[model samples]
Target: MFARRALRAAAPAFAAGAAACGATTAWLADEADAGMFVVRPGLSASEYKPLVVGGVRQHTDGTTRVRFVMEEPDLELGAVAAAHLMAKASIDGAEVAGRVAPVSPLTAKGYFELAAAAAGDSAMSKAISSLKTGDVVQFKGPVQGFQVGRNQFKSVGILARGDGIADALQVATKLLSDPRDDTEIRLVYSVRSADQIVLRNHIDALALLHPRFKALIVADEAAPQWTGPTGPLSKPLLASILPPPTEGDSTVILVAGDVDAASGKATKARAAGVLGAMQYSPAQVRSL
Candidate 1:
């Protein structure tokens, strides 16, 4: 009986190993900080435009209350990439840092949650208290967004120190498989060869399980040896993932650097066809 039990336990491990062998090679780093690309210093912040928008009060838990609103009103909120910046602020010339949090039903339109470690020192806290309804404040960060899960939505908020690509892929895959229901997971990213392999493998894997797990890849141009759907990521694909166009349901993936100008845009377009959108920079991903 003891031998039998031992063998039974080993069976699952053996199966897992076999699955991994057949699975496309995935570059997984254990540091929980892998796949991060950092923004280079000396890049003029002027490239970014700060937007003044309304923020809504969502539910508060502990010291944090979730808020939801489009980071930029003129731009179709769909254009915003997941895990990208929202705003940058400085208090008393001290750089005040905050990441975009995920959106949800509790999150009201034109508002998002901002928290501070304590009370007085954080600019977000001060802004939340001082700013009233319909008051516009200068805010600039990445166009962060979320993914769809089985029954819940995933958060698109990426820290400059967290695992970006891996985390996003994991969330997208889990959202598709675990539920055994009909649902779509949208993702976006700036294209890279390394990530293409992962995206292709993910699509192949999902195709085996869910026929409804449709995908769209959008890119400025095609890459060498690339094998997936390709196009300039369109509004139709964006609509599929974020039906009804609420802040809580959309996610944007941002990629920074001249890479976006070159292979990055093409890669992101490809990734968006299969995933959602590729919009995160290396620095932002590293913070994930």
Candidate 2:
């Protein structure tokens, strides 16, 4: 996770690429106060250009997963990963930050999934609420976020709630996929009910296959047939899940969801997200 400022420094290059891909002399401006990207002109802001919406799925628990085909043939998923890019979506004039996840191991051409928890009356929910197959949604990104060092830590502890599990998965996927990155990962997923748990099979499969990965799910309201831990993921739960920190600062905590109440960085355009929270401190912590 690199800072957005770093992405801005490379803005000229991004602008050039966008221009080559039907963008006309688009000017990139860093809204430093907002710590976000803003295209000054040349690109039509009012235009609702279409990106092929592949499909939309609603889970039994009300979570929504939207898949879109990246129409830009030049868009490289690997490049975005290497650059640590974060993106936002604009639909029905509502804009919200979104995270990209793998739809399939062997993605077909430029297809990927966009996930939103859509839990509350937030911008994300509003934008996602109106989504339909074939609707055109605009995206602006390749923006930067927190930067974790290359093999900097030996272990990562993730505490995620609600839709934030997507963020945890994003981090875990990167570290686990890198053969050279032998970092151990532990993830604690908290949700209101069993039905609310998303991507269980995927997470479970990763845990089963990867010796370095562990996943635990806690729900506030457990169904009669459910048998996992039940309760809020309070300090005690976290203490039990997180590994003790080793010397040389080889451990860090990454948090997402409901962090605003905890006075932690929450993926601000440039600042560390929940990773900057104080309670998880002494051990480094950041929000995604």
Candidate 3:
């Protein structure tokens, strides 16, 4: 749901031999040759040479984690971190744009965890529903937003659900990667089923590796083997998950969810001072 602010369009710039397989007819003005990918017209079936789908893993809960590999091992992704790319996919002739959460990175490959949605009036949901293995999806970004600096905050709380965890992970990785940033982070993620916990192992590894990082996963319906808390997010859950309130304004809480959770519209839940009464909304992604 994290969309970048649109930049001013530049003159049409095409690279030499833009006839790469899966390359779309339209390009983003000046960025066509600058690591920007274009989808084929009518979402035609074609093998993207440099970028190809490597593996597709589907969880029991209908969420999918797809890996994209680059044939060129030396491809430079720029300052784009995992989970920070705003990707637009063409599905059945329709365009659906959403954030692609970075999972793991290798010299020549990357992974993204995507959620499945029930057929509804939402364009993104419909797009997610239409996705299949070997589909050619084009993405271009490192959408501009917050910049990670040294010691930006004393502690940070992240609230997310399903695919939103990728967004939270992006922020966490940025903070933790910088050893100079001593910001403690608390991640509270909500889900409907245990099978939907796609990044559990990775999250656990981060918590185990970093003393300043902690994660709490909440499930709406827990299987008998489940050990974590189970129920809708409420004050008690927030109390147990979030860090103590800070004396200064240095503490921050970043919540990621649908428009309601992000904007605190429904339940009046987030507005109840979950993380020291902090809240802000730059914009909301409207549903289809």
Candidate 4:
């Protein structure tokens, strides 16, 4: 009887151990699935850095070819952003400008040849086509890196559409323009100019509904002849958009431009002043 009782006691213990193991296994499985997850937050303007890659040759057509090695083939944009943040705390302040080899499965020769064929006759397309073996070209922008997770890597590879300086600037601008204080806004801007126009129109419509926005400032270089706010965006014009700064609340500036905010003293200085006044970067501006 004593032996039977002991066995009965041990049976529950064994079952409990088994249950614990099963739970652990399930947890591990779930974690494994989550390993490769990546979240692509909107790009930022302050992150733009001018990339200069040597040994890169541009084709007559304007396509550019670059050769670089990437250690992680599965890396996604989110992973790259995470890595960038780790390297630099303020992603908006620093820029990563260089042409390095893609990690794997995407050889330089293969990538350029395919890119050239796809690009056809565009300036960037021609530049990509001219890339010969072992060529390198520079990519300029606020380098937005990615975050790598278990079983997955995020990478916004150089040359991928929608990952350019203009796009980054649009995202940054939107964040700064957000009316809500606590809400986080994430967005992606397109490299295509037409998309930017559409975004500008949308913003104008929103302004009609919301009184906070007094006017929209568009860069003169790409300004259309539309009736609404269209012309060279100037500091005075931008200042007019925000209500006078109050003691507790501050004003924000939204700038949109293809010009490099760094490099020359003029652009850099202007950007700094704007950033301080607006408490945001150009990336926040949306086309609409």
Global lDDT of each candidate = 0.34, 0.56, 0.53, 0.27
Q: What are the per-residue Cα lDDT tens digits for candidate 1 across 175-216?
A: 443444334444443233322222244445655666544444
The TM-scores of all predictions, comma-separated, are: 0.29, 0.65, 0.61, 0.30
- Over 4 Å off, model 2: 1-50, 57-64, 77-109, 116-130, 246-248, 260-283
Report the candidate with higher lDDT, 3 versus 4. 3
> Candidate 4 — worst ten consecutive residues by lDDT sum?
1-10
Where model 1 places Cα greater than 4 Å from the true spot, the runs are 1-150, 153-165, 179-182, 187-196, 227-288
Better of 1 and 4 by TM-score: 4
Worst 10 residues of 3 by lDDT: 279-288
Ranking by TM-score: 2, 3, 4, 1
* Superposed Cα deviation of residue 74, candidate 3 (Å): 3.4
Q: How well does candidate 3 match the true structure, expressed as C-alpha RMSD?
A: 8.5
Model 4 agreement with the true structure over 31-96: per-residue lDDT tens digits: 212232222122223443222223343434333434332223322222121112111111223332
Q: Note the clash tally of each candidate.
A: 64, 12, 1, 61
Per-residue lDDT for 20 in model 2?
75
| RMSD, one per candidate, in order | 21.9, 8.4, 8.5, 16.7
Q: Which regions of candidate 3 fall more than 4 Å away from where they truly are?
A: 1-51, 57-64, 70-72, 80-83, 88-97, 105-133, 259-288
lDDT of 3 at 176: 77
